[model samples]
Target: MHFDLADLRLFIHIAESPSLTQGAKRAFLSPAAASARIKALESQLGSRLLYRDNRGVDLTPAGQRLLQHARLIMRQVEYLKNEFTAYGADAAGHIRIFANTTAVTEFLPEVLAGFLAQRPGVTVDLQERLSRDIVRGVLDGSSDLGIIAGPVNASGLQVLHFSTDRLVLAVPRNHPLSTLKHVKLKDTLRYQHVGLHEGSTLLSFLREQVEHLGETLSLRIQVSSFEAVCRMVETGVGIGVIPESAAKRHSRTMDLTIIELDEEWAIRERSMLVRDLDALPGCVRALIDTLLPASGAEPPSNTPT
Candidate 1:
């Protein structure tokens, strides 16, 4: 049996759209040509891959399996391309990192700026994602490394201790919670809250934690960044939960009071995650070392444990 790479790619596009014409258009192929390729692929596999209707095509069991394999293959292909992109005359090194909102907004920018200045040939693609999603992306070869905050469920990956931070409540100086030294999120849930915009990792994590407490989190106002969240909270429109660093920084200038969260999860001990460091490219390994400064202890082994 034989399979063509183009056919696999076309099939993937079709699986995503579930419409032959739409898939063909996305793949930059004529509808008839894409149909022929898929039909030929089905014939080669001796399986009927699609069930067509006026609405769209549905994947058969075999097609579903193929789609899974195809996606995995494409991800690996992309990983290969990403790893090798630095080798050409275009750049010296390239790496992709997935990190939580705290790491992206509070920590990484300054560190990455220094790294980029020293290695002008290196370019990084940093993305803000949930810790769980970051772990998944790193493990699946879709991302080179993940910087996670809070507890980490690290299995089948090399874990390195990174940094620690805290989450605290930012409230207007005269607000009800302003007098408190420490408070649980549940205690503040009854009050209107300012929040980061939708799709933020911190917002999603807060919602998940609230759901576990058998409550819902409603935002009085939503803003784009942590600074914006603090600024809104200062106006007395609502209180907001922000990083302790951000709360402190903003309190210096804004009329906001910082209250530590009386919860274990509020103490965010960060960690770095990766696959086998021994297997990564030299420049990528250098980046990992740069990100994880020495902590007066034995260095992490390049080998995966």
Candidate 2:
């Protein structure tokens, strides 16, 4: 069945919020008006879109299926608007991006600084989330572009490798490991470790590597951001592992010692994910040229498995 953008927007909002009232507040419509619109759309579609009980409102099975397509359709509409907007003024379109903590704090500033310098009219709106959430944002059409660590696989979107980073082990400057040029996995694991939350890609990689070495990782703390991890390391809480680039950036205040992981783990790829490569706007094209000039859309990483 055909649907308008407004109908799809309403459906998305309703599906995201637990209650109709919350959805109504987000859409700036009264509770009665919001309920009426939902009912009208349900009538047109000839199906119940939501189910409400003690747990508040939730989308029905059909609603879940429709929401997927609705998101894709809405993304295309936004792409069209951006393309036209770019035509009005060179490099003057909105680029919404979602990035992980490391990408935002360490990677994007230089790239965006150059991008904005070249395209003064273009404005960037950025959302910082975990790597996995950033991928979801790109897949869900909430973000036009995303930068993240690790490998991401999605059906329609294209992934391009923009850079590769070394994952290093960091400890307080005075820690015993600090004097070593390179640390063995066993030596590093002997001390308490600071890790990311369970599902974080960085933690997964480190944990897997440690597990393969027949060692149990002793985690002292699990924080969401690398900055927090560094701060903890400074106070002798635990040694933290993160991207080498990030550790260097924090070296001034963190007073942390960093060493290369002697193991054969492949370097992490810092990649850019876009919905459709060929459909990129001019400003996007310019940014791509700046970031991946000679690479020409490379794969995630060459780190040996």
Candidate 3:
């Protein structure tokens, strides 16, 4: 019937961490004290919160439910602290945004730079995550805004057209496919590929598309970013499939050739998603405005294909 903020904070830490000891360390509590707190919290709530095993701990159903509420509560607490602190000085705000790989790598830097330039007191926490994780973060109040690509089941969120891009092949100037203006993915699958890391959204999408065609991509090297992929392709390691914007930019600096893809799914669109636009803070709303494309202007197309 009674609990403190420390208990909730500790509970969240434990649920996220692989072990109670690690969680305790993160919460700045001794292991013994943290265990005692957990026991007391469970007793007061009349439910078990974690399942113990040799590998680590897993959250119980009740613990999962509590975690959702705890995150929301902590976010509100942070907002309150920032709001009150703003009155004593220049109005400063903090906004957290989670975006997928394409948006993070190609789009957000310029948009965020312009926003930060105008509001020197405000700070933005930007993180890169897959589209699905970004959606989950926004839905759970873990992130204030999200920009995602591809088809997303956004039944419960407000969606806006953010930007559009296409996937293209980046081949060395002398590669076999360099002479073609546009080639189908199936045609390119026969050669080795320089791809992004396994968990990257663009790489996963490419794999999914290849699988859908009853084929597999022969990836020769996997790198952390598009720049690395382009660099690898430039050295004749393998061709790379990357966002058109990135390929174009790197082509100027590197001896790489850009070839468009002839697949329908290659034309990707990005959308900005939020839980509720009406409920957003003024600073967040202003950030959204800055991110949105100019009125009556068509979304910038990344490639002619």
Candidate 4:
């Protein structure tokens, strides 16, 4: 079987248009020519792709499935072009990034995975550092950029609003605190908890926050990862504080509920920082573009607030 970009584009046009003739016109092909191409495509795939009548054309089941994939392939091609076109060809290099616990643990891995998959020439040295330290690293040339949470005087760095890091409490469905929408960290300190294992960046950060209140987390059990903590919480071992994203993912299958923390620190904007956006390398620029997709994020009107 033979399939190509031209076939995919022609198929997508036909699937999207009101009639086969219009689709062919949009694709800059004669209607007869387009019809022959579609028949050929159908023969190659061993399936009927569309149903034609006097009124118009409608996609068959196989056509619908093909349409889905064809659209995705077109989108990925467009994205690849955009990633490379902003600067010239992508340059091979390493991007040193210092990010906070939330970015490092919850979001960066998945975000980086897709970016790395497309650009094999690029490599990243990612380290989890505190927000202030991340800012300092970007400032002093220690790193190309940083993803930071919470506030510091990020005066010299170029800040692009990243994801929101909302730390929420995961409680058993029938637990007393489950009825409450928000619970302050200080109020929850008295209860037993399930926490990430020692040396976990987030756990260390939480320890410092609690220490500020002259109290400590009463960790009854320690787990290696967020999912484990949620599993323990589901069994009524103890409540756990984890990223809302992680909690929501686990809550679907577990008997758990997420309660927001009644503290300013609980909700903070995670911002991407670079010393100079204009002066950045092409690879760094491409990485930034991939991370800040148009959906679920606005084009960053950058400045430290």
What's the number of clashes in each of the models?
A: 0, 0, 0, 0
lDDT of 1 by residue, 186-298 (tens): 99999999998777888988998899899989789898888888888878889998888788887888988889899888988777788776666555677667766732224
User: Ranking by TM-score, best first?
Assistant: 3, 2, 1, 4
Tens digits of lDDT, candidate 2, 61-175: 8888778778878767765676676345337676888876667666578878977887767888877766667777777777778887777766666777787787888899889
Off by over 4 Å in 2: 86-90, 117-121, 172-174, 194-237, 248-257, 293-305
Q: After superposition, how far is residue 137 of candidate 1 from its true place, in Å?
A: 3.7
- How high is the CA lDDT of each candidate model? 0.80, 0.77, 0.82, 0.81
User: Candidate 4: deviation at residue 235, Å?
Assistant: 2.1
Model 2 residue 83 lDDT? 67
lDDT of 3 at 195: 90
For 27-48, candidate 3 gives per-residue lDDT tens digits of 9999899989988988988999
Kindly provide the TM-score of model 4 when superposed on the true structure, using C-alpha atoms: 0.66
Q: Which stretches of candidate 3 lie over 4 Å from their true place?
A: 1-3, 30-33, 53-56, 87-91, 294-305
Candidate 1 local accuracy as lDDT?
A: 0.80
User: In candidate 2, what residue range of length 10 has the lowest lDDT sum?
Assistant: 296-305
Residue 214's lDDT in candidate 4: 96
Which pairs of residues have clashing backbones in candidate 3?
none
lDDT of 4: 0.81
* Candidate 2 backbone overlaps, count: 0
